[model samples]
Target chain A: MTTTNRQVRLAARPAGEPRDTDWQHVEEPVGEPADGEFLVQVMYLSIDPAMRGWMNAGRSYIRPVEIGEVMRAGAVGRVTASRHPGFAVGDHVSGTFGVQEFCLSDGRGVTKVDPAAAPLPTYLGTLGMSGLTAYFGLIDIGRPEPGQTVVVSGAAGAVGSIVGQIAKILGCRVVGIAGGERKCRMVVEEFGFDAAIDYQSEDVRKALREHAPDGVDVYFDNVGGDILDAVLLRLARGARVVICGAVSQYNSTRPQGPANYMSLLVNRASMTGMVVFDYADRYAEGVARLAEWRAEGRLTSLEDVVPGGVAAFPETLMRLFRGANHGKLVLEVAGGKGTGTVIGEGGSR
Target chain B: MTTTNRQVRLAARPAGEPRDTDWQHVEEPVGEPADGEFLVQVMYLSIDPAMRGWMNAGRSYIRPVEIGEVMRAGAVGRVTASRHPGFAVGDHVSGTFGVQEFCLSDGRGVTKVDPAAAPLPTYLGTLGMSGLTAYFGLIDIGRPEPGQTVVVSGAAGAVGSIVGQIAKILGCRVVGIAGGERKCRMVVEEFGFDAAIDYQSEDVRKALREHAPDGVDVYFDNVGGDILDAVLLRLARGARVVICGAVSQYNSTRPQGPANYMSLLVNRASMTGMVVFDYADRYAEGVARLAEWRAEGRLTSLEDVVPGGVAAFPETLMRLFRGANHGKLVLEVAGGKGTGTVIGEGGSR
Candidate 1:
């Protein structure tokens, strides 16, 4: 039997902001699984700002996604056919399954997810890569001690939201910097952040000074550029700045660097950049803890799923760049049948 | 009986390079100790690049040296008159006694030095602040592991010289970047550095690339600016760059920063600045390790002493800025002494 799969392919490299011509939706036949492979029907696809970096043809922590290849992404799906020993036919699996309706996997770096534990879309958010990135970057790289002031940028977004919550769990005074007032409120109310700064309404530097009077001990930087510059000025002595992602500058033609980095000298601070893939061997440990937190009702997972045919992939993913998504943005490819109900405000499934 | 003492005071803050007009020499009658204070006869005065930063009218890791005050410096001296219980007459001690022939101390942050263990100048160099700065900055900040490739800038200077040697002891492949060929040769032969790059004669980037072909794992940066930019381009993943001092930009009217800092993101590395004074509580740990290395004949201490009266303090201290001194530069205040033989190029003591 032949299965039809709609895939998003990279048609051209984007200079600054990605346009319609940059991506192409191609319909292809999904073949049967080979000897050692399994066939998966894609249920939810993770849309991340890191996708912009993968479009560029340069060396980074990870290799860029090649041209004409199904646009690389993380997805949670149900296995339809299995020839692999570890995976069953009805098992829920997540991996680099690309932006497609169906995926064939050889079981390399693929993991099974439980629907009863939480929503299936959450496996792509809180209990997935975004959650693991926040955990290791804050806990291991930042190393925030108890009672230390922890500041997080992009605080309303998926990774930043989890990072702020983890800092709070570590007994730190948590402050967040988000784009709007609504997002700021969500950061404080949902994530248990002590204070929030709306970057659009308030002057970040002034708000930071008022909130973090003793200066920031750990800055979990997700949006680099001017926000990073503002945080640099408010860093306390021996501060650790963890650079997880630079979403604000990822789509810029010319990336703007921090102007006042010399503050690192006066503050005797350190700025470290980390890629979550580097901690791949220990990802299970982070996922286990995050799942436990969710089970205990200590951590709330937010996922915004847009339900439509696979043709809506480009526009759905663009919502993240426009700051339209308040949580982990996921595209639902299989409709509402097998996929669970969407519970959040922006969710439609 | 009245004793005359000579002191060098900061006349004014210099604009770019400090001139002779920036200092004033004054002679005053040395008073006797009060209740607990002791009078120290200054012998060896340390002249460091960090002194330039102290003269600037801005906040730093430490407070700026005040105008019209005695020029600040670390000095090794003998207690000529004592009333303090911790110190006795004829005891050798080291502290921030300034550029003076005598200092009155109540034993705050002052430590006794055994001249018989090593020369009095050795206490100001290998056994004192410079040695401790190198020890902690390399091991604690740089975190060089065994078999890692470690690079050190200003490698022939006081702190950098010791940093390269300590990295060697940790089983790291040590590379030194120095100004002249003579200093480069001395760094390899005396400090046991694996290789030395003549930054003055050769292209810094090319030489660094050749010396550290596999990329630098730990970079102990004493000279920042362009050398830091050169090292940034060749950093390995998870590399640690320790900023101990910025000697290259110390005298600049407007300090220039490294342009290639984006390499930190690409390499997933960290750059941290450190001040040795912050590790004051653990200074004895550094001193003991350095002393043990010296005793085992594995580490050699180099001191270049300029023999003159306290009136020559201004000119003697300028040798550091000019890079005229090959090793730890110290001023020997002339007074009642035995044969004042200026020994050149000998082992420790």
Candidate 2:
């Protein structure tokens, strides 16, 4: 067995957009699993826009990553060794394994995954944390009833795509707000959105008013900023705005403050911020439902897999912030073979 | 039968603080009740700060009072002549009867009050709409759990006083924010509040920090502005901020916006604006419970009745905004037999 493991570590916190100088790549001999711990070689790593927020030095739903720590991320891997009773060698698992070649886990929050149920990378995308986030945020927090108009920003991305589709399944009139015509069309045609607004070419507020003539009942906001302000103007009475992420403001040199929040008062609406980790107790329910939808072909699982080893960690993660990935942006660390590739079996890898 | 009746009509919209020119006093003959309508002789009129919001020319929870309309107000009056099946002559009733000596109602949302259960004026205070507003705003919207720290602004006034006491009944550590030490002390002693902050004399943020070191779990806000901004900074995780009214901003010539609303994001809190009219259907449950508490001496029925007939209406109503009212501010409109007496009876009416 190979003794060395490559990992990406945060060298310093960035002021705005993270630079390569902010990260340090290091290789160390892989250590054996201790009692009640298991060792897994990471197969895929999840790159989320929220990772930028986790790098900031401030109080949030979760603690920010400290300097010199392995950059925190979610990963799917194959357990190579186990000293814990709950896991064994050859078992497929997923957890917050960080941006590393191998991870050591005590099974605190890690769970076993079945490749036969979905693609291995889907555990990091549509069937994983992203999927669960959209599921709980839209269904529970946003609480859109049938015939209600549901608007989703960042609608082409992993979380937003699932959110819009779920609203569609609930018999809502779903609208997607994305950057360009191509992405907007994909969301409406492929994801079953009723309408799509090309935010790059249209005035968001005007476009929203046209698409949602009755005003927006639920706004699943993944990219907050001016778009959020635009949506605020068109909110129906008793509208619910679910704040899943604020990707548009993540790279701002100064804090991006919302300008038109008083609309919440005029419309008697509410804005609620949510983190999926808060619903950890009910994650199985979300996972089971998402998995069933994918199996029934009602939900499409999309993953933009960047084929590269641990060296591509930093670059692969940036694709999410750049809007370079149409689907879930994940880094293929170890070989895709035997790591679980059921959903990606007939697709180009 | 009275040969003439007096009424106060909105003469003009005020630019800022209302003046004498904004209202016009007119005399007219009392008309007979139409079919399905009843004639009510106004007795005790409720002068709430919310009246200021109604005068504004914009869409709100309720429609704006037009220029020529009689000034809208809630009044507890006696039915003089009844043609409506639901009501009869001599019945004590409460409705949006407008500010006049005589009012006509068609039995829409009017409730008959029992003078035996409580005095007619009490029907305009603790056991009426004010009581229901405090009950639902605290329990339904704020959702204060036992052992949680609950805070309320406008603490000495009608709704705030009831809110603090209701929180106490729910086993919460209640804090009140009022303008002066007198009202603060009254809130603590009369309403069972654990502490009270004289926001005008002391720093609200500092006081809240010291009083609720664990942070505020629920904030029932009647006053919004700097006090609201202060409370925003001290919210506990998953805290609920109930925006029942923004009395502080009602008279501002320029709109006052909350500067620290981002605290909602940092604390994962929620701020919900609500109007009592939304819960009109469930008002009976609230009134029933409030009356029961007053009967058992568990809840203090506080009323600050300003005597002098209908001529003093404008001046008496101003007392609410000036913090001159120790509890509910109801006008003694006709020199009734029970003038200047605080009705201690407990029940509806």
Candidate 3:
């Protein structure tokens, strides 16, 4: 057993894309649970595109991670030690445990999950923040009616994939925009999108016109920049654009804005930004609905569980920017395994 | 009265700023109206910033003014000849009469205006489309609560001046942003804005921070360029941005998009586009309320009333872009009355 916990911290604010030097690897004595506290051994760390936003030294939806602090992240783990009456050792839970192998928690925001029912990695992605983000942003903001066209950018990412599926379940004609042929194929065949546009190879504008001939009614924007501009021109009358995340602009020092925003006026449309945390009160309702769908086999939890633990946090995050991950990209603690490959890497979930 | 009508037609599609060559001045014989139509002698032509948008050959809220076609405009005039039962000679009316001396109308979209109640130019500006735009955009989209900080751009122009005044009447702290010292002064003193920021002289972001220290609750954006970007950064939680017009970008080949739009996500805010034409169903309701306010001394109408008739349109339109016009820029039919200036030329409409 390792006596020291290895953690990744933000060493400096990144200018563009974060390099290896931007992160600092430090080792400290494993923390113990204090009175009314519990210790969590992080098993799965969520690798989200929004992580890039937290590294920036600016105001955002949430506070930026300070220099020399453990990089803020959503993680699923097991309660190893506890002095709290509500929690016991060996209980599975999830919270913002950060980029660390061990986390000392007071159970303030921690949620107890059943590892036996759903995999631990699933809790870090589909059943967690990513799922809630897709749920609230699509249902509340996007508000896609049946027979309407719903377009989602970053189709293979954690939140976008779920957004497309949920829109599909609601009877919307779903079209996804993704980078590379593989992602485009996965977006359609795996996630059940009506169609997919390979943004890397195809003219996104032309592809959008072909896929959604009636125009996009609901646009769940995971990637901003040029994609947002392209989608703006194709909005149907009274379209609702959910500005959920801007992964493409996260690393950009000079983020591009949508020049075609006048389309909103032409179409009488609205562009609204949503933060899933605002729906904290409705999280249990969201989880219950998502879990219900999962049990009924109407929903599939997709996770690309990569091995390397907290030390591999920097490289794993790059996978999102590179569009290398197939589904929900998650990193877990290395247990004498250095495969660096996705576990259960095929078929639906 | 002249028997020949001098008309300005679109000679070419403008690339950036409209030039003299973009319009072709042609003289045509005045035509008589048929049984179902009425002929109008345009007395007051509305010279709006939106005219620049109509010249562009692109998809917008309204159809672009085609090359070689009569330039589009809103005008208030008296019916010279009426073959229709609804319209009689000498009846004061307002409609899309175009940039011409005489217009033939079917009375389909024409509305009767009373010159006794308000000035004829006011029917083309403050009590017309510009006023309607301000009313619906502020009350419907902005929905500013009492004590909320409401900000407006193009404050000395038609829509923005009215927007600021309405915000003040609604019990909001209103701040105006306009170009140059003169326009800023007019926005505060003449339009009754709480404070005014001269975009050309002051740092807009800094001025916003100082004036709206609590952050802006509602931002009525008449100019959408760098100023829109500046206001986006200073938005309070759940701020509503009303995208009424982009007077700043109307002449640009490549309109500058707001680079800091992500501030929308940071503030959980919304940017919504509004076209006054969309509220055609509620125009009477809006006009009635505005008229009531005017009668009670709670609201005032403002118009520059530049005299160049239709011939002075090209130059008078430039006044809006040059920040020359202090209020609603209106150009009546060339009455040969030299020394063209405002009608009232004093405090409040």
Candidate 4:
């Protein structure tokens, strides 16, 4: 068992995009599990757009990570020691374990998973927070009906890729909006989207006109800015806009709103915001369904795991802003090898 | 009977805030009604912020008024000649009669109202589109429950005054936001709002924090700009924002989007757009309920009627943008005696 735990802590808030200097790496003696507490060796840490929001200080859906605190992250880890009845040694578990080599927890929000059933990294991607978010945001807020055109922003990313698949499974025509041609191609071929819009090269509104000629019925938005404005213009009557994340605006000093939001009035549509924590009670149902689809060869998850473990968290997180990494970006702390799946890099599965 | 009909036609589309050069006055011969047609002598024209939207050349809920065409308007008039089964001479009717003294109609979108039961101007105010807009937008879209806090921008305007009253009738506490001290006082005293915020003088966000300590449950927005942003930041969990109109943005070449719209996600709230015309089938239901409330003295309609015939329409319409009108703005083409109601000055009934 490891006696030293390496952790990443926030040194300062970023003005725009996060920089390496804003975080500090720390080495600490591994914490021992007290009575009713369990110790975990974190295998992988989830890198998400939400982490940027967590770094900010203000009113948010969740509390901001205080300066000098371990930067918040969702991770899948194995129990190294157990003093709690709910957790045991060798059991794979998922929780808000921060960017650390090990975590000591008392079983609050910690859920057990079977690594034999799915890959350790898959538990942090398709079967973890991303799956639950896409499930609830799409099914509850998006409410896409069969034959509806469902457009997803951040189409090559974690939650968005799964959102498109689930939308297709529900009999929707899925169109994904991504940064480049390669990611767009992977969104179509690997994620099973009907069409993909390369927002970098093409005009989103004109592209939407060709792909979704009838207008978008359900728009699951992750990156908010001009793209959100573009989708607002082509919304079908009584359309639903699910505000999932604003990754594009998260780094902007002046966040751009959907300028054409009046289209909601013109189309009699609705824009609703969704937060995954609101669906905590239904996580089991979401996991069961997602797991079932995966086991049946209907759902697929891709993990872009980076090396360097905990200390590399700050740099790997910046990749999301630069659109450098694809699929569910995760840092493999315990894998000790180049083990992330490469599915979204053009024609590759 | 008048042989000549004075008309105001659109000469050019306004770049911003509509200048006098954008319109042209014309004297045309009164046409005789043919088979299945009727003639209407327009009495009062409804002056609304929506008029500004109709001048813009783009896709909207309704088509823009074409240049050289008589500017579109909702008017209450008395039928003079009728060759149709649904209409008779001297019958009071309401329709989009334009800024003209005479209207030749085939009775497609016209509805008859009793001028004897109410005043001629009331049909264009509380009993017309203004009343129906307030009814449906408040009840159907806002959906305020008992004891909930309802915030309304443009609180002293036609639709807003009635919206506050309807929200009050639904057993909710209402806070109104309007420009100027007199308008603010009128919103509280005449409109019976629980509180009023003068956006011209007071800080809207700080005022909201004081007035709506528990946060706003329903926000009926008319003047959407910084005020919408302010209210957005104070929304309670599961709040609903009914976008009735963006009077502030209608005149701008570059309309401002609500920068704080992401607050919808933090509160798990929704922002929905409401167009009064969508509730056309339910107009009778809305009017009936509004009339009942007025009859019971629980509701009051204020008409900021301007004296001067149809030729004064261009100038009279500007009153809405200037916030010069206290109540429902009406361009009186035939009310030669300056008989418009005097309310909403301050501390008046």
Give the clash count for each candidate: 0, 0, 3, 0
Better of 1 and 2 by DockQ: 1
Q: Residue A114: error of model 2 in Å?
A: 4.5
Each candidate structure's TM-score, on Cα atoms with residue i matched to residue i, is 0.86, 0.84, 0.95, 0.95
TM-score of chain A of 3: 0.95
User: How far does residue A187 in candidate 1 sit from its true spot (Å)?
Assistant: 1.9
Which residue pairs clash in candidate 2?
A: none
Model 4, span A110-196: residue lDDT tens: 999887899888988899999999999999999999999999999999999999999999999999999999999999999999999
Alpha-carbon shift of residue A310 in model 4 (angstroms): 0.6
Lowest lDDT 10-residue stretch of candidate 1 chain A: A340-349
**Cα lDDT computed for each candidate against the true fold:** 0.85, 0.84, 0.87, 0.89
Residues B65-140, model 3: lDDT tens digits: 9999999999887777778899877677899999998889999889999978988888867789999999999999
* DockQ top scorer: 4
Which interface RMSD does candidate 1 score?
2.4
Binned by DockQ into CAPRI classes (incorrect, acceptable, medium, high), candidate 3 is medium
**Model 2 Cα lDDT, one tens digit per residue, B1-349:** 3646788888888887787888888888876778998877788889898888778886666789999888899988877777888887777888988888888889887889988889888888899888999998899889999999999999998999999999999899999999888898899898889999999899998999899999999999888878988898899999998888877777777655565555676677887777788788899899999998899888897888888757777777677767788889988765274322212112122
Q: What alpha-carbon RMSD in Å does predicted model 2 have with respect to the real structure?
A: 5.6
* Candidate 1 per-residue C-alpha lDDT over A214-301 given as tens digits, one digit per residue, 9 for 90 to 100: 9999999988878988998899998999988888887887666665566787799999988888889999899999988888888888
Give the number of the best model, judged by lDDT.
4
Model 4 local distance difference test score: 0.89
- Candidate 1: residue A194 Cα off by (Å): 1.4
Candidate 1 regions exceeding 4 Å error are A1-4, A11-27, A57-59, A88-90, A251-269, A306-324, A335-349, B1-4, B10-27, B56-59, B85-89, B201-203, B251-269, B306-325, B335-349
lDDT of 4 by residue, B1-349 (tens): 3578889999999998899999999999988889999888788899999999898898888999999999999998877777888988767789999999889999999999887788878888899999999999889998899999999999999999999999999999999999999999999999899999999999999999999999999999998889999999999999999998998888888888888888889899999998888988899898899999999999988988888889888889888888899989998876534223211111111
Q: After superposition, how far is residue B212 of candidate 3 from its true place, in Å?
A: 0.7
